[model samples]
Target: MLMKATVSGSDVKTGGIALHNLQKRYGNAIAVDDVSLSISPGEFISLLGPSGSGKTTSLMMIAGFETPDSGQILLDGKDITRLPPHRRELGVIFQNYALFPHMTVAENVAYPLRMRRMAKVEVEKRVGHILDQVHLGALASRYPHQMSGGQQQRVAIARALVFDPPVLLLDEPLGALDKKLREHLRNEIKTLHKEVGKTMIYVTHDQDEALSMSDRVAVMHEGRIRQVSAPKDIYRRPADLFVAGFVGEVNLVPVKLKSGTVHGPASENLPAPEWQEADRDATLCVRPEHLHLKTSPPGSSGGLQGRISGMTFVGDATIFQFRSETGLELLSKVLNVLPETMPGVGDPCVASWAANDATILTE
Candidate 1:
């Protein structure tokens, strides 16, 4: 069991990190471009995106690890863009544990405290307290080699928190762990954040991790943030095509807006409700999970026909890849337990998705 709640004040009582017109360019190649965001104190914000999308670069700027070509980084309304990383007073846990192999877990966790020239008794007390907090008290005397990857990561986290820094920065901290272990640690990390109540900036390319752990996620793309919102909002209503495609599996269908109604690729095949007048050139974004696979009632409105191209069972649901009669590729997700027989490959299937499930986007 973990330690019960303690009424220690906010870890980063200094209002949190802010970036204004942040830009980083490496010889004409823009790494992070004109990004402005403010992370609130005690909030866990994740920079999420695919590789080379500027998520890590932005996090590095926040951590004072990377120099921005232009812009201001403010911590608690005070500029810290030119400050050295150590003077920023933030805790950081890197991808590679970065623990000395020769050092015991206790020693590793105590190093930060020792650097501050803290008293021996105080260091021991704090180290012991944090070891217990990370559930590594039993292995305190063991070296990194003697511990599992997960255990070593716990030690790294304990070390980061040992100094009680105002903010925490995690850069792909769970990337080295296996899927199940990673998922387990994800929850543990969130719980730790709540327990510590420290402002955290997490960087990762994994959408699931970002969606599950963040208070708010900023989706980066091509060196700029595409969208920043809560997980459900980001998934359900993405701001643009990039976000819709990046956040999850989505099918993009070419749509033409005529008379305020969106027509499918097979124009006028499906009757859709009239859309707003401003929806011209809109593309429909539909998630596989929202598509319903069923037999078509004769001439049912807003229904389309497709043939099952492939089906894959994925634990809780079956994914159906359908090739529409209109030559469009689509997918549907059906719950595993339902008796509604899944259409086999090459079988004719009627696929229908709610008009509301599809998001209309231009460009």
Candidate 2:
């Protein structure tokens, strides 16, 4: 259970951030290019991309650790582009838990308050309250060396919260933990966000973290944001080819659009993009899960006829690789229940999906 901490006044309604044309460059190389985004108060937004996509660099600029070459950083409509990190009054958590080795959990959590010259009694009270809130009350006396990675991360979170800042910036806070622990901590962090209601700007390269935890995800690529949308929209209705291909495992099929129809390998007269021009080339994006597989006659008419070229059982789901009669490869994912019903390798199958399940990408 996490406790809510006040910032300024009870009715302040703080934690809105806006980045306007923020750009950063390293000599001739552009790290961030014309990036702009507005986050609502108490919204949990994730900057998601592969490494060097400028997610971390954008976070650093917001934290005041890195100055932008051009543009502005505004918190609640006030420009803080040139403010120092400590003066920005923002809570920041790094991938590495940057706790002092010699400090105990309680002392570490109290460091922010101490640095502010808070009275000793108030610091001790806040430390005790936050430790208990993070379920670290019993480990208050444990030094960093005596704690596990997960516990150390909790200490970092508690420290960040102890000061009760309006906004929290997390840069891959769980990147150092093992998979199981990372998943567990992800839930805890989500719960913390709800309990505290602080605006959270999370930077992560992990799609699962962004998809599962964020209210909206800003997908970045090549130092620019490709798309900003809710997780479902980001996955289902990606804005472009880059966003479709980056967010998930997708099968991109080259096709031609003519007279309100789509023509592709082993497929014709399929759905066409409502806004796309006719008689042009486009790509079809479909996720493996959307493609359904069923044993069918060699010459199926309703769907593409294919042979199961390969099959892989991945715990909860099985992945089936299908080779269409036209030699186009497609993948289908099916739940593992009733394994006897699944098609075997080399079996004739029909792969199909609803028209709406596929997206047409012009680029």
Candidate 3:
């Protein structure tokens, strides 16, 4: 049987979250600076950025945990900027499990229902349902201390969903788990979000996590929403220098734009009619995956030559560090399979990519 996909707050909901010129400040530092964005209904959106970028602060404002210094926050057509935390009807999952060590899994999941004065029978029914949803029904009687980290996370998710809130807010929910466990639970959390069908707003600094899980990603920087788009668009076509560098591994080569083509320090040229006619200063941005490495001498089409500075095996792909004669430090990825003739460290090699492979950025 085909598996049914889980639902996030996006399922039952038909509207989205809108921030209109939202701003928050503390003395001289601006936490969120006139930021605005529209989150589609049911869209899995992530606030992705490094620490102190105001992503968490913006989320707190939406949850009514922090008051915005200016602007409006709207859910659907209603203004919810001033609503209290309890009145906002949002399910919040934090980095910490925040479960009571003394309470059994069932009790922890049932806590939310009890807070609303739900009857004993109704609470049990809801708790049972959520435990089954999180695949912890058999371990319902076990306490937090008795379960693994992943299981504890499931209990937290269960508690968040048991009340059936309108929105689910996850604040780096997988931050504390080990690498393998984090990867496993990432899919699980995504699965639970879909099953619950609640509109969700996830926050994290991990780029891979955001890319793999979110339907759309909001790249935040210096108290602003720098770019908001689908995961592919965010990675393939970044809006600025920050987005390009922050989203993935890439090498940037300074170049000059003349008559619609980009001229790098080396002989390789880029196709850009607009850039050729544009300003003199430009940059060529290329991802690691697009680079081609060769140990032989160049043919009619000569590529940039460089010395292999280092090589590291990362299982699936090997990372090569190259220093071009023109002073460009570049990193390229090669497949792990043999007969591809991987470049050894300190070997002189040629690096080349298609003309269309490089992105021209004026900044």
Candidate 4:
């Protein structure tokens, strides 16, 4: 019987990574601006953004693939900004997997150790250890072409870890797989991180992946980091307009701030934002799930009159869009469990939420 390979929490090498005011430019375009980040030892951080948003460029610079125009990158307290890619001692996994086609899984995993000229016996020992660790011991002799995508991916990751590099950088490692496989691999990667305890930097445009796996997510846009925070905080308490709008679904309603409240576009009074100054134009940001929709306006302050416009059946829940009597559109998410209680489109309803659920973006 084959068993999954094991690694003790103490078995993996660990390192801290820091990027100090990193800047990179290509011709007149700035790929990464003066971005400084301090990542803790063994923490998993994701550089997340859309295309041309500088996340990938920052990762490449950390890996020594792209030279920065200015600033520095430190690994375990040493500057490696100018070091060549191979000399930086970093393990990298690309979207393509990058496994040599003709090589057996064992050969592919062992190639890094062999390159260092380790004794053949030691190389064999290390290869066997990692093959078991990744649960690929039985398929050691099989070539890349003979394995499923997930298996090939496992082989690629095993190759990266076999050499015991202190830092692991993954660029869209799960971009190619189907949803089910991607979800499985994500759990595997998270488990691997716990066992190995090495600093891991992952780059991806997938919000779900970043939010689900990372210890912290650095949201990047327009060559700058918009916000860096834990997954829940990034979604619930974004720092600015861009970050609030980018990370997830939020209903943006224009409002003008007063001494103690936000006057909505529909001339309704909503809760005052804790952070806004008096008399400023702002947008009231509230996520759909935070809004409660009812058939009639609530007995008191929580309710805001609205008419249901449309709804969408998102796999886990239904999202309903409502137009307030003042002509402002807002959204509410209702779970699918209650068929009788669920409101239909065009139904007259009231949208209500707690004052704390809203963030007023004055900028």
Q: List per-prediction Cα lDDT, in the order shown.
A: 0.84, 0.87, 0.82, 0.85
lDDT of 2 at 307: 92
Tens digit of per-residue lDDT, candidate 2, span 1-363:
111112222223478888888899999999998888878899999999998999999999999999999988888778889999999999999999799998889989999999999999999999999898889999999999998998999999999999999899999999988999999999999998998899999999999999999999999987888888899999998888888878988878888887677888655565435534688888988899998888887766767777999988899998899998889899888886477787789999887788889999887
Which ten contiguous residues of candidate 2 have the minimum total lDDT? Answer: 1-10
Which prediction has the highest TM-score against the true structure? Answer: 2
Give Cα distance to truth, residue 242, candidate 4, Å: 1.7
As a whole number from 0 to 100, the lDDT of residue 258 in candidate 2 is 73
Candidate 3 local Cα displacement, residue 136, angstroms: 1.0
Ranking by TM-score: 2, 4, 1, 3
Candidate 3 Cα outliers beyond 4 Å, as residue runs: 1-15, 271-276, 298-301
Quick one: RMSD of model 4?
6.7
Q: Show where candidate 2 strays beyond 4 Å.
A: 1-13, 271-276
Highest lDDT: give the candidate number.
2
Residue pairs with colliding backbones in model 2 are none
RMSD of each: 5.9, 5.2, 5.5, 6.7
Residues 57-77 of candidate 1 have per-residue lDDT tens digits of 888888899999998888877
Number of clashing residue pairs, candidate 3: 18
Off by over 4 Å in 1: 1-15, 269-274, 297-301, 337-340
Candidate 4 per-residue C-alpha lDDT over 1-363 given as tens digits, one digit per residue, 9 for 90 to 100:
111112222332247777777899999999988888877789999988899999999999999999999987878777889999999889999999999998999999999998999999999999999889889999999999999999999998999999999999999999999999999999899998998888899999989899999999989998888888899988987777888788888888788887776787765787645644677888888888998888874343445787889988888899889987777788888777467777888888878778888887767
On residues 264-319, what C-alpha lDDT tens digit does candidate 3 reach at each position?
68646644334535447877778898887777543434577777998888999888
Q: Residue 125 lDDT in model 1?
A: 99
Model 4, residue 221: displacement in angstroms? 0.2
